[model samples]
Target: MNISNNVSSITAHQTLLNTSANNIANVNTDGFIPKDTRITDNAGSVRTNTREADNNGSKRSQTDLAKEIPNEIIAQDATAVNVNVIKTQDEMLGTLLDIKT
Candidate 1:
């Protein structure tokens, strides 16, 4: 199994979810603007020799930073957790392989 794709997809999803959650959490905060998350499919079109791949794009939220800072921190924490999880999983798999050999 190609863990790279899975890891990346999971990370992307976590980012999207975190962004959305942050936006929603601050929906009632004054001057708070929600951020928009978008996934771009760059594979559909080829520009020269480059193959387009989907990239995570973030949009500015209408919510004010005062309200959004906390959520931003939470999002950053979540991203860190996700990265750690992926790394842990990869390491475990590697250990298993070594043990088998």
Candidate 2:
């Protein structure tokens, strides 16, 4: 198992979660441009990119709760999954070593 890739993915997802939380917190603040998190696969690892929009679509609001809330949930879920994967991998490796001993 490639633990490095899982670690990277967890980090990226955490960043995404933070960005979404920030956007939601500043939803009503004037002149606050919300940030969007973009994730991409780089080889076997994950990469994160954040983009700030000049305007929040056609809406007059500074932030869009409809979008930000769902995004935060998605990011949180993804992060949790990655952490579970890493734990599973570690357990499997330990079991293998025990059998060899």
Winning model by lDDT? 2
Task: Provide backbone clash counts, one per model.
Answer: 12, 0
Off by over 4 Å in 1: 1-62
Return model 2's CA RMSD, one decimal: 2.0
lDDT values for all models: 0.54, 0.84
lDDT tens digits, residue span 29-97, model 1? 665545655434344421112222232343433544564466456546755765777788889999999
Please provide, for model 2 over 2-46, each residue's C-alpha lDDT reduced to its tens digit, 9 standing for 90 to 100.
Answer: 889888988998898899888888877767778878999999889
lDDT score at residue 55, model 2, on the 0-100 scale: 77
Off by over 4 Å in 2: 56-61
Pairs in clash, predicted candidate 2: none
What lDDT score is found at residue 2 in candidate 1? 41
- TM-score for each predicted model, relative to the true structure: 0.43, 0.89
